[model samples]
Target: MAYQPPVRDHLFLLRDVLEIDRYSNLPAFADASMDVVEQIITEAAKFTGEVLAPLNSVGDKHGCTWNPDFTVTPPPGFKEAYKQLCEGGWTGLGSDPAYGGQGLPHVVNLSFSEMSSSANMAFSMYPGLAHGAYSAIHTGGTDEQKQTYLPKMVTGEWTGTMNLTEPQCGTDLGMLRTKAVPQADGSYRITGQKIWISAGEHDMSDNIVHLVLARIEGAPAGVKGISLFIVPKFFPNADGSVGARNEGVKCVGLEEKMGIHGNATCVMQYEDAVGYLIGEENSGLKLMFVMMNEARLGVGLQGVAQGEAAYQAARDFAKDRLQGRSLTGPKNPDGPADPIIVHPDVRRMLLDSRAVIEGGRAFLFWTALHGDLMHQHPDEAVRQKAGDYMGLLTPVLKGYLTDKGFKACVDGMQVHGGSGFTEHFPASQYLRDCRIALIYEGTNGIQALDLVGRKLASSGGRAVMSWFAEIDAFVEANSADEKLKPFIEGLAGAKAQQQDATMWLMQNGLANPDNAGAASTDYMHLFGLTGLAYMWALMAKVSLAKIAAGDTDPFYENKLVVGRYYLERVLPETAAHLAKLKTGSATMMALPAEAF
Candidate 1:
C-alpha cells in the first residue's frame, strides 16, 4: 500500500488551529506564510510517498547485511533511495540557515519527517539521527567545531548517531564503561563498545559523525565521570575535506532485530578512536540530552507515523474485506456478506485508532510549537513558560503518545484479522517497527517516572499550575458557546481529574516512594488524556467558528465528530487511570520476590 502523507490535516492545523502566521515575527516563521508552507509540505509528500514508501517493504524483506570489511550494506534499493533523499535535501528542513539548510520551523520539519517516517521508517532513521546530532553540535559545539561539522551534516553528506547504550547499561548512564583518555593533542581517545547504535555504520553517506558517551580516565565515579565525544568515521582535514579513515572505530557486529532491519543497528567498537570533547568533561550528559530530548520527540512521531500507516491499511481493509453481516442489517445485502465496515465492533476499532492518530498528531505539534516559541518568542515570560512546558510535556508526549500509538497499531492489525498477521501485508512491519519506540530514548516507564518524580515538581510546580490555568481559562472563555459545550465540558472535566490526581500524588506519594513509583504510569496516561482534551478543544474551537461562518466543508464537520468520539470514548480512560492509580502500591507491592 502506498503511504499518503496527511498534508490536508496538517494544512488545517497550521492554518486554522495553530494560525502559524500569527507568529510571523519569528525569524523562521517570517518566511513561512501558508502559501510557502503548503508548497514545502506538498513537495515533501510527493518525495516521501513516491520515492520512500516503495522501499519500506524491500527494506523489511532484505534488511541490511554485515560484511567482512566491518561495513553494513543497506537493502537492495536503499543506497539509491538514500542518494535521492540527500539530493532532495529533506534532512536539514529544520536546521539553522547558517549551515546550508532551508531553516524551516521545527514543526514543519517534523511534519515532513512524519511522512518520510511513515513511508520508510528504517531509512528515515539515517537522517533523523543526523538531525539530532546536528542539533547537539549546533547548541553545544565551539565556533570552530560548528564551522567544521554542521554544514555537511545539514547537507546529508555525513550522517550521525548517538552512542549511549552498552552491554550492561541501557537507561542508567551511571553504569557506562566506555572510557575516554585525554591525549597530548587535547583530543580524547575513546575506547568503548556501544550497542544498539542506529545508523551506526552504513554505506550511504561520505562519513558518520558519532556522538559518544564515555567516562574520562580517572574521573569521579558513576555518571558524574561521563563525557560526550565527537567521533567521526573519517577525519576531516583543515580544508573541511574527508581525510584519513579512523581505523579505531568499527562496526564489529549488527543486531538482527524484530523490525526496521533496513537501518543498521550495530555493535560499534571504539578502540582509541580520536574524539573531540563536546562542551566540557562531566557535563556530557547535559549536552547529550539536547539530542536525547529531540530524539524522544522524533521517536514519539515514529509511533504516530507507524500508527497512521497502520490505520490507513486497516481502514481500507475494513471497507473492502468481506466479513460477517452487521448486527442491525446488512448494508451490502447484494454481496455475500457485508464489508467489515458495517460491523459496529470493527467501527469501534477504527475509531479508536483514528482518535489516537489525530489527537496524538495535534499533541505533538502543540508541544513542538512551544519548542519553537521557547527559542524565538520575544517576551521573556512567554519564552520561560514555553521552555517550562517543553520540559514538563516531553515525557508525557513520549510516554503517552507512544503507548497509545502502539495500541493504535495493534488495533489496526486486529481490524485486518489474518491478512495483517502475514508478511504479505504491511501491518506486521508497522507493529514491529513501532514496538521499539517505547523502549528507546528512555523507556515509557522511565518517562512516566520522570513525569511524576521530576517534571511535576520542577520550578516549584509552576509548569503544571500553568497548564491547569491555561485549560481553566479556555473552558471559562468558551462556556457560553452552546455548540461547543460538550467539548468545553469534557475538557474541563478531564482537567479537574488531572488536578485531583496531582493533589493525590502530592498528598500521598511523599510519604511512600512506592506510591509515586506505582502511580507513575497511570498518572502519565492521565496527563496525556488531559493534554489531548486540551488539544481537541483548540481544534474544536477553530472548527466550530469555521462552521458558524457558514463554511460547509465536510472536513470541519468530520473534525467535530472525531473530536466528540475522542471526548466520549477516549477521554473517559482518565477516570479509570485515576481510580486505579489512587489505590497506591500496597497491593501492587504485596507479593514477595520469592513468591513469584
Candidate 2:
C-alpha cells in the first residue's frame, strides 16, 4: 500500500485544535493562513507519496555504497528525489527568508517532516540533518559564518552533519579525545575521528558542513572545555563557492545498521581539518543543545511517522486479507472467511496504534506551537512560559513517543503474522526503521533521566506546576459537560497520579538520587500518559462542540470515538507506571558486581 500523509488530521490539529491562525501577528505566520497552509500540506503529500514512498524499499534493498575514495553514492533514485526536494524548496520551508527560505512556521515544517519521514526515513535524513545544522549555525554562528553557510544550506546546495561521538565517547562528551588547536588565522586545526556521523560524506550535495565538538588545547577537563567548530568537507571561498578540499576529512567506513540502510552512518576521520569557531569558546555544550533539542524533537516525529506508516500497512491488510471467521458471526458470509478486521483482538491492535499515533500527533503539534511561540512571540513573558513548557515536555515527546512507537510498530507486525516477519511486507521495515528512534538523539533512558532530574526542577518546578494547573482548569471547566464526563474523569485520575509521582520524586529523590534514576522511566511514561490524556480531553471537547453545532462529518465523530478508546483502553497505563515509580531503587541496585 502506498503511504498516505494524514493531511486531514494535520488540518484538524492546526485549525481546530491548535488554531495556528490566531498567531497571525507573528512574522512567521503572516502568510500561513488556513488556505495557504492547506495548499502547502496537499502539495507536500503529493510529493512524498509520489516521489519518496516508492523509493523506501528500494533504498532499503540497495543501501548506500561507500567507495575507497572516501565518497558515498546513495541508493539509486535518492539523488534525484533529493534534487526534487531541493527544487521544491521544501528544505527551506521553516528557514529565514533573508537566506532564500520560505520562513514558514515551525509547526508547518514539522507536519511536512512527519510526512517525509513516513515516506522514506532514510532519504529524509539528508535534509533533516541539514536542517538541524542550519538551526545551529543560525542560532550560534557569527555573522560571517551565517552569511557564508546558511544560504547554501538553506537552498540544499550543500548538506550538513554533526560530529559528536568519537571512538571512546558516545553520550559522555567529557571523555572525547578529539582535539582542536587554535591557529594564527583565527581558525582551528580539528583532528578527530567521529563515529556514526550520518550524511557525513554523501554525494548528493556540493559540500558537507560538519559541526564538530572538540576540546581545545590546555582547556579545563570534562564537558566545560568543549567547543563547537565548523569543519566542512571542502572549504568555501570568498564568493561562497566550493574551494580546496579540507585535508584529512575522510569517510573511512560506514556502519552496517539494522535499518535506515540508505543513510550513510560514516566513521569520519578529521586530521587537521580547517575549522572555524562557532559561538563563544568552551561553551560548545550549551550551544550544541540548540541543535540536539531540535534533533530530539525530529526523532520523536520519526517515531510517529514510522508508526503511521506501519499502521496504514496493517490496517489495509486487515481490511482485505481473508482469515478466520468473526466471533459475533460471519460478516462476510459470501467470502471463504471474514477479514481479520472482524476479530476483536485485531481491532484492539489497530485501535492501539491509532490511539497512540493520533495522540502523539497532537502532542507533537502542540509542543511545536510552543516552540514557535518561544522563538517568535513578541511578549517576553509568553516566550519564557513557552520555552519552559517546551523544556518540560521535550523528554516526554522524545522518550515516551519513541518507546510507544516501537511497540506500535511491533503491534503492526503482529497484525501481519508470518508475512510481517519477512521483508515481503513493509511492516518489518517500519519496525526496523523505528528501532533507532529510541536510541538516538540521546537514548530514551537519558531522556527519562533528564525529565526527572533536570526539567522537573527547572524554574523551581514552574513548568510542571503550570502544566498541572492547565489540566486542572480544563477538568474543572468541563465538569458540567455530561458528554465529557468519562474523558474528564479519566484525565483527572491520570493527572492526580502524575502529581503524586512528582511529589514523591521531589520528596524522595532529594535524599537519594538513585530513587530518581530508578523511577525516571516510569515517571516519564506516567507524565506522557497524562499529557496524552490532556490532549484527548481537548480534542474531545472540540469534537463535541462540532457535533453540537450540527456538523455531521464523520471525522469529528471518529475523533470522539478514538479519544474515548484512548481514555478507556490506553490511559489506564498510568496506574502501572505510577506503581512502578513508587517502588524506588532499593531492589534495582541490590546486586553486587560479583553476583552478576
Candidate 3:
C-alpha cells in the first residue's frame, strides 16, 4: 500500500486541539496562522507521498553500496529524493533565520518530520542527522564556525553525522579511545574509529560534517575529559567553498543491518583528521547532549511515525482483506467472507495501534510546544519551567514511544498473518526499521536510567511537581462534565499511580540505588502511560467541546471513541507497572552474573 500522510490528524491537532494561533505573541508563530499551517501540511503530505513513498520498497530491496574508494552510495532514487527534499527547503524548516532557514516553529517542523519519516524512514535519516548536527553547531559553535558551516548545512549542500560509538563502547562513553591531538594552527588532529555512525558517508551531498566526540591528549580519562570536534570530510577554505579532502576520514566499511538498508551505517576511520573544536574544552559531553536531546525527541517522533505508518497499512488491509465470517453474523452476505475488520480480535489490534499512535502524536506535539516555549518564551520563568518539563519528559518520550511503537508494528504485522512475515508486505519492513529506534539515541535502558536517576530529582523535583499540577488541574476542570468522566477518572488514576511510584523511588532509592535501577524501566513506562492518558483527556475535552458546538463530523466522533478506548484499555497498564516497580531490586538482583 502507498503511504498517506496524516494531514487531517495534523490539522486537527494544530488548529483545534493545540490552538497554535494563541501563541502569536511569539515571533516564530507571528505568521503561523491556521491557514498557513494547513498549507504547509498539505504541501508536506503531497511531497512525501508522491515523491518519497514509492522509494521505500526500492531502498529496502537494493540497500546501499560501499565502494572500494572508501565512499558509500545510497540506494537508487535516494539521492534524487534527497535533492528534492533540499530543494524544497525542508532541511532548515525550524533553523535560525540568521542562516538560510525558514525560521518556522519546531512543532511545525515536527509535523512534516512525521510525514517524511512515514513516507521513507531510511531516506528521512539523511536530513534528520543533518538537522541534529546543524542544531549542535547552531547551539555551541563559535560565530566564525557558524558563519562557515551553518549556511551550507542549512541550505542542504552539506550533510552531517554524529560520531560517538566505538568498537568497545556503546552506552559507556567513558571507555571511548578516540583521540584528538592539538595542533599549532588551532585545529586538532583526530585519530580513531567510530562505529554505527548513521549518515556517516554518502554521495548525496557536497560534504559531510562530522560532530565527533573524542578525548584530547592530557585531558581527563573519562567522559568529563571528552571534547566535541567538527571533523569535515572535505575541509572548506576561507571563502566557505569546499577545499581539499580531509585525508584522515574514511568510511572503512558499512554495517549490513536488519533494516533501513537505504541509509549507510558506516564504520568510520579517522587518521589524523583535521578537526575544529566546538564549545569549551573538556565540555564536549555537555555540548553533545544538546544535539543528543534533540535527536532523542526526533527518535521519539520516529517511533510514532512508524506506528502511524503501520497502523494505516493495517487499517486499510483489515477493511478489504477477506477472511472468516464475523463472530456474530455475516456482515458482507454477498461476499465469500466478511472483511476481517468485522472481528473483535482484529478490531482490537487496529484499535490498540490507533490508540498508541494517536495518543503518542498528541504527547509529542505537546512536548514540542514546551520545547518551543523553552527556547522562545519571553518570560524567563516560563522558559525555565518549560525546559524543566522537557528534561523530565524527554526520556519518557524516547523510551515509551519506541517500545510501544515497535509493538504496534508487530501488531500491524499480525493483522496480515502469513503475508506479513514475507518480504512482499510492508509490515515486515516497518517492523524491522522500527526495531532500531529502541536501541539508538541512547538505548531505551539508558533513557529509563536518565528518567529515574537524574530527571526525577532535577531542580529538586520542580519539573515532576509542575507536571503533576498540570494533570491535576485538567482533571479537576473536566471532572464535573459527565461526557468526560471516564477519561478524567482514568487519567486521574494513572497520574496518582505515577505520583505514588515517584514517592516510592525517592524513599527507597535514597537508601539503595539498586532499587532505583531495578524499577527504572517500569517507572518510565508508568510515567509514559500517565503522560498519554493526560494527552487523551485533553484531546477528549477538545473533542467534546467541538461536538457540543453542533459539529457532527465523524472525525471528532472517532477521536472521542479512540480517546475512550485508550483510557479504558491502555491507561490501566500503569497499575501493573506501578505494582512491579514497588517490588524493588530484591528478586531482580538475586541471580548471579554467571547464572544467566
Instruction: Please give the distance, in angstroms, between residue 79's alpha carbon in candidate 3 and its true position after superposition.
Output: 0.9
Model 1: how far residue 344 lies from native, Å: 0.4
Q: Which 10 consecutive positions of candidate 3 have the poorest summed lDDT?
A: 563-572
Residue range 133-180, candidate 2, lDDT tens digits: 999999999889999999999999999998899888898889988999
RMSD of each: 0.9, 0.8, 0.8
All candidates: TM-score: 0.99, 0.99, 0.99
Of the candidates shown, which would achieve the greatest lDDT relative to the real structure?
2
Off by over 4 Å in 3: none
Per-residue accuracy of model 1 over 149-239 as CA lDDT, tens digit each: 9999998999999999999999999999999999999999999899999999999999999999999989899888889999999999888
How well does candidate 2 match the true structure, expressed as C-alpha RMSD?
Answer: 0.8
Candidate 2, run of 10 with poorest lDDT: 284-293
lDDT of 3 by residue, 30-58 (tens): 87888998999999999999999899999
Per-candidate clashes come to 0, 0, 0
Candidate 3: clashing pairs of residues:
none
Clashing pairs in 1: none
lDDT against the true structure, per candidate, is 0.92, 0.94, 0.93
